[model samples]
Target: MQNLFYALTFERTLDRYSQADTTEVDVTAKVDPAGRTAQLLSAFFGLDEGLPRIADWAVCDGAGGKDGMPVIFSHEVGLNTLEPGDFAIKRRSGKLGEVTCLTLAPADDPGELRTVLLAGQFGSESDPPVSVEITGDIISLDQSVTFKGAQVAVTPLEDGPSLVLAEKVPQGQWELGKAATGIPFGGGSGCPEGTAQVLRVTWEGGITKPDGNAADDQERKLYRVTIRQEDGSEETIAPMHLADTGDGDNNHKLCLDRTEPVKSIAFPAGGFTDPRGDLNPPTYIGVSQRLIDKQS
Candidate 1:
């Protein structure tokens, strides 16, 4: 079915003089029982709301909660964590059968976690690759191609350095410019007749930093993508390493821009590999038609 996850971003006050530190907790799994209680205060708060520690809590509705109100729960008993007891959990308003499907874990920093729900539950560790025909890769302000597929199989770590995404803006050309001002910034109305928006898809994997510190110890991976157009033409997007210094600040190189429209994109079998020389089966995430709808 579908998988739902919750992202809880909050700040915790450790001591009087020390600075308040921020952390995130991911409730990826669903609680059991139709009317069970899902106590969240323990992991996030040590006391009551008067302390006011929570920043924001977001619920990402997955497969089962689309029709009904997003999976809701109630709190039972006091929220004091000093007392010993498991947090009571109950599924309030949703389908009870598959409500508790996902298994979750605690995340300190949520920036590194990039999750994509596998559409139609298609990809398996053992499925053969499929070839599809695509026309041309086109990017536009209104509608564009984007990715939506599997969860980021690679875990993110602060020490595990990875290449950042960069955009290229030529002189007299803006990355997200408006038609009137001729400036390369967002929030412009109307696009030029000839030019299109450029949308690039890059694979981010784990890598070791020069300082000999790899946080998660997950090695970096490299994979080349192949674009299949409707006209039966094939083009390959070269794989680049993490930019040395210039990421997005300096217009290093344009990987994908609003140039042409693409029919279908595909990844070859046995394309993914890590630094240690391990490979993964062919799998693809969903590419959105409007990835750059709005920066805000």
Candidate 2:
């Protein structure tokens, strides 16, 4: 016989402007019976978007269980608090049925975040009545019911430089020279006028096979480049393939002009292979172009 279970996934971001704190929270709950899966839903009232903006949220099921008989709720919250293994929770009881809650916390060593689990039921005979555990800060639930909402705190990071456009460039592929300009420089003081910058590129994007022939698609590959500045800051630039130029003989090269400064440059080979047939396709290449300046 098939049974029905209710599931709800909750996610929220917490932003504290005064303390510059931000965090992400993820909550998941599901009921399963026998071997079938059930639909999860969230019932929100009023016009508010539930909780305030947070860093992130995630949810999952407990270990070992099926559709409805044994349901589990797991929640993961990411924050910047020094005490990562601590949390505060407030819950409202469901109209009918049973409810369970569990709480899990991370260790004090500063690696994993804590967790909490809460489990309960409207009518059931179990030892310890409503049980709660505190391991660092992770919670686990065994019985089942439902929860209304949750809240947490987090930390925020100021505007910072990051690595973007770190993908492989397809081979036999060419991009326009004009497209090479406009690479974003890491946010910092400008570099000297005449310095040689270096960029190290790597392959990351996926490849596909259009024709059944393994050799034809294998011949197509990608390239990339990386840029490094004098201040130890760096950026990467990779040529994006516009379209196939037929066969693969008419390969194009996107070059940086001499007028442009060479801050950094690095190129890596692409790695791609075909699975359906017995052919190892060409690797993708990434090129990192650095802006170089002429010595005064």
The reply for model 2, stretches above 4 Å from the true place, is 1-223, 230-232, 240-244, 250-296
Give the Å shift of residue 11 in candidate 1.
16
Segments in model 1 whose C-alpha atoms lie over 4 Å from true places: 1-254, 263-277
TM-score per candidate, chains pooled:
0.25, 0.17
Total backbone collisions for each predicted model: 36, 102
Give RMSD to native, each candidate: 18.7, 22.5
lDDT per residue for candidate 1 within 42-86, as digits (tens), equals 111011111111111111123222111011011111111111111
The TM-score of candidate 2 is 0.17
Model 1 lDDT on a 0 to 1 scale? 0.22
Instruction: Give the candidate number with the greatest TM-score.
Output: 1
Q: lDDT for each of the candidates?
A: 0.22, 0.21
Task: Pick out the ten consecutive residues of candidate 1 with the lowest summed lDDT.
Answer: 103-112
